[model samples]
Target: MDATLFSLYFSALVAVYLLPGPDMALVVATGASRGVRMALVTSLGIALSRGMHVFMSGLGLAALMAAHPVLLDVVRWGGAAYLLFLAWQVLRADMRVDTTQGAEGSAASGFTRGLLTNLLNPKALMFCGLFLPQFVAPERGPVLLQFVWLGAILVAVGFAFDAIYAVLAARLSRRVRSASPFRKWLLPTVFVLLAGRLVAS
Candidate 1:
């Protein structure tokens, strides 16, 4: 990649990562509710999903989805439904009590939630398809190689941001009382809002 183009791409990536989105909301919620370990696991799941999106983009799945609007709607509705399910889970859980049956199981569920949350969103895949191509330069190297490099960078930067948010949220949660209504309701509210946003979009 050309040095200047790479710099520009990096700048754009940073800007995008800084924006508050569902992924950030999910990470922060998980951190605040369950603690840093679960949040980190969630972030890892999201990173894996992002990597898969990049791979699918490389295979031109984005174009396929664009050609088939029905497919996109299917993903969009599915994502929204999943978000609502997460919201329900949050609402029903008693955060004041340590009701978790097992740490390992809880972590697994968190990872699955994070992975599915991002993976089910058609917009995220479409974004990978659109954003990655803008930075690819055929003159600099093989196009596929350039895409791979760019995709790797995108996932790395995104994961870094998510990790930071997770840690900060976890630390903040420690200062607030566990019985606080705001602490209990925050994740559910965020999930519902995200679901609404996905449906609206």
Candidate 2:
């Protein structure tokens, strides 16, 4: 990749990554409640999912779906439903797990959860197919090689920002530990927004 093109793409991607999202929230929440080590592990999970998406994109799965309009619509709608399901799950669960009040629930394997969550998002797969072409120059090198490099670049950038978010959330959530009621109300809102985005697009 050309240095100038890589810088431009990197800047745009960083801007997008900085925006609020579930992945970021989870990282922050997990880190605050657990620790940085757990948060870093979760970031690795998200990166693994990104790697899988890159593999899928290279196989032409993303592009081939674009050729079939009906299939694309089905994917879009199905993704919307999944997002809503996630939203519902968030709403139904008790947000606050009081570590101070009682024995905490068993520690979740956050890394695996993060990886599975990202891999399952069809919109993310579509975005990968769409976003990469803007920065890639076929003449720069072999197409697959370029694709792999760009995917790695994006994942690295995203991982760094997610860690930052984790630290910030950890710092902020410390004053209040018994706000599960509020968190319960707040977290579902994100999933609902994600679902709306899917439906609107």
Candidate 3:
């Protein structure tokens, strides 16, 4: 790929990652409420989802969904429903800051939440299909190879940002009381809003 084109792609990717979205909100919320460890685990799950999305895009799954709008709607609605379910789970969770138990279990749940959140969103897969192809130069190399390289970069950059958010939120969380209403309600609110956004989209 041309250096100028690669630079432009990187810039655009960074800009997109900087935007406030459900994935970022989830990581920050998890860090604030749970701790850095769980948040990092959640980020890992999201990274895996993004990798799968890229793989699916390379296999032309996005094009298949585009050809059948109902399939897209099914995925969109499913994602929204899952987000709402997560909101409910957050609302019902015990937020008493118990460090003695359920750490392992909660971390596993967090990973699943992060994975499903992105994986079910059809827009994410479509984004990989659309955003990646724009930067591909047919004459430079194999198109699939270019996509793989770009996808890896995208996942790496996204995970880096999420890790930053997790650390910052965990630091800030230390100052607040575990019993605070903010910790109790912030995550549920974020999840609800994300669900609404998906439904509206």
Give TM-scores for every candidate, taking all chains together and pairing residue i with residue i: 0.92, 0.73, 0.92
lDDT of 3 by residue, 142-178 (tens): 9889889999999999999999999999888987775
Extract clashing residue pairs from model 1. none
Model 2 Cα lDDT, one tens digit per residue, 1-201: 667877899898888897876577667766665556566777888888888888788787888877876777776777667657766865665554446544323234456656765766666777788888777677777888888888998889888988887677666666577854454555456556756766777
lDDT of 3: 0.88
Candidate closer to the true structure by TM-score (higher is better), 2 or 3: 3
Off by over 4 Å in 2: 25-41, 87-109, 176-181
Residue pairs in collision within model 2: 96-180
Q: TM-score for model 3?
A: 0.92
**lDDT, candidate 1, residue 142?**
91
Sorted on lDDT, best first, the list reads 1, 3, 2
Clashes per candidate, residues 3 or more apart or on different chains: 0, 1, 0
